[model samples]
Target chain A: MNIYIGAENIISPLGSTAEENFGALSKNSSGIKKTEAAGFDKKSIFFSRFAENTNDFSFDALLKNCLKNVRSKISPDIFSSEKTLLILSTTKGDIKSENVNPIGKSVSELQNSFELKHAPIVVSNACASGVIAINTAANFIRAGVYETIIVAGCDVISDFVTYGFECLFAISDKPCAPFDKNRTGITLGEGCAAVVLSSHKTIFNVEPMRFIEGTSGNDANHISGPSRTGEGLYRTVKKTLELAGITEKDIDFISAHGTATVFNDDMESVAFDRLNMQHIPLNSLKGYYGHTLGAAGIIETAICLQSMRNNTLIKSMGFEEEGTVKKINIISENKKLSLETVLKTSSGFGGVNASLLLKKS
Target chain B: MNHLSSYCHISTKEIVTDKGALLFDNTEGLEVNDFLKTVYKKLAIDYPKFYKMDSLSKAAFLGVELLKKENAALAEYADDEIALLFANSNASEDTDKKFVNSYAEEHAPSPSLFVYTLPSILMGELAIRNKWYGESLFVILQKFDAAFFADYCNMILLRNAKACICGWIEITEGKTEAFIFLAEKNGNENNTPLTKQTIEKIYKTIMKQSRPSKV
Candidate 1:
């Protein structure tokens, strides 16, 4: 069973659609800027936030907005079909409003408003939530449980999360510079994005790409810290490639989980080095879209699809010098390339890492 | 040939297995912490990390440890061949509230509490204890859906894993319900297909046997 993935949509600070987001990326325009007294300590911090004037600021609103946009690109009947499933990925869903049960009401609203035949599966596996949600969708399709799945990832910024990171000293004071020497920490952002995966490629309005396969691995090291050996990320990529019957040589680019935290970037660099994939073109969009937590994976993967469609590679914005102990090629400028196969990977707080491969169909 | 091998359940006051035997119980109306500690001590698994775990992780750790005790073969499998699938209705709400109170009431946020805010961190704790590198996923459904677990475990078994430990560990307010079952690609002593009905039957039996009146 071949999984076809496309119909990518996003509602981020940069733009409202994947094409629009890619347009901003092509011109090297970033969404990150300093917010006044945003930190827990009343320190101004860099964040990618929507204008106060926008209507899609809340968690539920952004999810609805992105889902409606995605619905426009696919067949209308899929949403109500029993064979189609919706998988929501988020670290914290509406936590600021309903801390007692953050995700339940939002998920219920999505099901009722969208008229989905079945309840959606809500994934809250920290940052890897988005990546794992996509993988879970593919598994469902492959097992014939569902013919189609809409993998939606959404998260909104809140004082609760901000203070948590602030207490841990993880929030960057300036714009995050992924894989850069001076990189401090992540600048949290908020957004909603989704992609469609189906056994029937015709459901997609645009030509869908082949979703080869994906897998996850655990570092088994620490809950809040990344593994120095990148054990989980490396093993996941290895398993994914082996399952897809490919190698590092077949990959044209990598959309890495460069959180800009010293440990995370270096850990990824170490993993890429260990995999002997140092020569592949790689970039982290966190610089443009800040670290959107659960939405980061889906948003970045959508941009990867755009990169494939346009035959262009987006730069690792905010990256100037080689920083990691291991040497991996980080794109510093936008360039054109015939991208045939690409890989996207994400590692999060729970000692979890995930990877997936996309090939031109 | 995928089948349910072993299962363990922990209600607010009782700890029982699928073998028609109660391993332990708290008839004294002890607090959640004290009850879990009594079970941990009975097992005599002296891993100090238990003290640091949130109530959710502590309960799950106890569940898995008892599972290993019942099915010794669980440890025989290769590390990467065993996967962990856990979920809950409330996520880490108990810890979330605590973390919030740390900043809102205590005037300072604690990093330790913030680290355990995500429910999947409990899965991480399990992975570290066992050193398993297999695929792990934690999902949130509105309630305990045995059908979903069966579907997910079947999907996971399609991968390289030979066995999977699926759990629904929910800890909220003063309520606690932890149930974990092992699904093997092949049956060991007995054969019970890993279907929705089988999982539901087993969990229901445990629920009925543990608290009796509460469930």
Candidate 2:
């Protein structure tokens, strides 16, 4: 069964809609900037936070707004249908809550607010949450469990998360420079992005892309660090391509998971090199999005869809020179590309890697 | 033709298998960490990384160790065929609280504790220990829904994974309990058909034995 994905929306510091975010990328603009006293030590730190995020703006509000936007893009009755499920991808949803149940309350509120018949499944698998959630949806659709599933990913910057990263020194002082020679570390970001996938294409109001296949693999390595050999990423991408019955040549562009952490970018480069995909034009949206944790996969995948729609390739922002030990083609400038198939990849804290394939259909 | 090949459960009070055999019992009212440590010693497994894991991860790790001990076939499966699917209601809450207090009170953020803040890091520990490179997911549900695990196992058994390990772990203070099982595509003579009804039956039966130790 060929699953279809459309009715996508993104609410990020770059912009609210897919068009605005893509436009900013086309202009080579980034959302990351220094925020005053944002660090645990009361020092300034670079973050890609929403300028419109007033003190009143909350995580629930971001999800509600994004869901509303995507709801309008697809059939109005889908949310109430028993065969439709909402899959939420978030690393830390309201982590500041005293209860420490980051997603339980939010899931309940969403179920009540949206009047969803099926209880939403929450995927909190660190940075890979978004990609895993979408893959879960795709699996359900293929297995005839759910005809349509809405995958929403969101993660807001919190002091708990910031302090943790700060202690690890994983946050960059300046904007993140993914796949760049001088790339430092991640710049925290916050956003909510949602995409709808269905077995029936008629449910989508816009032209849907073919959801080819997606899969995940564990690195069986360190918990906090990416594999030195990029074992998990290589395995997942290989499995995805094998399942889709396509070779590396079938993928036009690659949406790489360039988190800007020294080990991360190098690991990704190693994976691509091992797969013999080093020559593929690839870009990392982290320079613009700042590694938005759970939202990174969905936000970046939405950008991939838009790249297909506009026939434009967004450059790897903040990248200047070759960095990794292995050689690869990194998009250095925004240009037109006759894109047909693209692959999105994500690697996170749990020594896990995930990849998804999408094609213009 | 999916089968519940083998299962193991660990709590603060006891460690047992699905065949109603008590592998170990705790009467000293040891805390969760100590109880799991004793169980580990009883199993005579030597992996120093065990101490670095949080209570949740330790529980899942111990459960997997027990599962592998009972069913040698699982240890022999291809590394990518044993998909690890785990879930928890609290989701590393105990470690999250510890990390939060480390900064909020001591004004010192501990990176080691912070790394275990994600619930799925337990799966990482398992993957590293067992060298199982299969697909993994750590979902957060309000409660342990047996039917959900059964359906997910069935969904994967037919497609990618040859065996699925649906692990459920929760460390609520001293009341730490973890249940892990290997669901195989082919059944053994002692195996039960993988179904929602069988899973619920096994869940209730195993959960009833996982009593809390008075810390």
Candidate 3:
């Protein structure tokens, strides 16, 4: 069974639609900006936030907006079809809510508003939630469990999450510079993005790319820190390539996680080098969107699809110099290339790492 | 179809096996930590890292330990063959509240508690303890849905994993309920096939027995 992914939608600080976000990226524009007195201690912190001046940037609103945007790009019947399933990926969904389960209300609301046939499943695997959710969609579609799956990843910026990262000193003082020597840590961001995966390609109003294969692996090492050897990442990428029946040589571009955290970037570099993909052109979208936590993977994959459609490789924003010990080719400037296949990888807390292959249809 | 090899249930009061046999009961008026510590001591597993995990992780760890004890065949499988699929209605709520209090009520935020705010951290703990680098997924559903679990387990087994350790572990408001089950491709003739009815039956039995009618 061929899983076709299309009708991508990204509602981020950059733009509302996928193409608009990609256009901003092509122009070297970043959504990250320093917000005065945003930190826990009233310190100025850098974060990519939706430009909407109102505090109405709630999780439920973002999810609805992203889904509405996605609905415009795909067949309307799929939303209410029994054979279609919805999967939501988020880390801390509406953390500020008084209810203990922050995601339940939003899931119910989305189901009711969209008239979904089935209750949505919410994946909350830290940052890997988005990638893993997409992979789960592919798995379900291949198994004939659902003919179509709508995977939406969303996370809103809240004091609970921001302060938590601030306490860990993981928040970068400036816009995140992934794969760069001066990169300090992640600049947290917020956004909602979604992609549709279906066995029937004709369902998409536009040409849908093939979702070749996706898999996840655990480092089995540390919960908070990445593996020094990139054990989990290497294994996941290796398994993904093996499942896809393709070699590293077949991957034209790599959308690396590159969270800009020193340890994370180093771990990714080691994994790529171990896979003998040191020279493959790779870029991290974190520099543009900041680390959007759960939304990072979906938004990045949507950008990857946009890049394939445009035949342009967007540069790794804020990446100016080599930082990792194992040298991997980092895209410093936007370049036009004949990109046929792209590998998207993400590594997050909990020793979790996920990788998936997307090919031009 | 996969086989439901073994399962274990952990509630606030007792730890029971899949067969509805009580393994351990909390008679010491112990809280979550003390209850977990008592179970850990009874099991005689000496892993210092267990003390550092949140309540959610501890419940999952204890449940897996009990499952492994019941089904020794699980130990025979190679690492990276067992996928961990877990879901809960209240995802890390206990830890999330603690983290929130750490910063809002308390003067400083605790990094240790903040790290466990995500429910998947429990999966990491299990992976680190067992050294299994297989696929892991942590989902938050409205309630325990047996059909979803059955369908997802079948899909996972078909894809990459040889077996799956699936659970619906919910810990919140000083109450805990964890039902962890092991699903394998083939099992002994006596083993039941992993189906929606079987999972729902087990969950209902445990929930009913653990929480008797108030009347």
Measured with C-alpha atoms, the lDDT of residue B107 in candidate 2 is 90
Tens-place lDDT per residue, model 3, A145-193, is 8999999998888888898899889999888999999999999999989
Judged by DockQ cut-offs, the docking class of candidate 3 is high
Q: Which CAPRI tier for candidate 1?
A: high
Per-residue accuracy of model 2 over A240-276 as CA lDDT, tens digit each: 9999999999889999989999999999999999999
Model 3, B61-146: lDDT tens per residue?
Answer: 99998888888888888889999999999888898888888888886989999999999999999999999999999999998999
lDDT of 2 by residue, B62-111 (tens): 88888777788886789899898999888888898898889888899999
Model 1 chain A: ten consecutive residues of lowest lDDT: A93-102
Question: What is candidate 1's lDDT per residue for A4-110, written digit by digit as tens?
Answer: 99999988988998999999999999999888988777889888988876565788999998999899899999999989999999998878623646689889999
DockQ of each: 0.81, 0.82, 0.83
Instruction: Tell me the native contact fraction for each prediction.
Output: 0.85, 0.87, 0.87
Sequence-dependent TM-score of model 2: 0.98
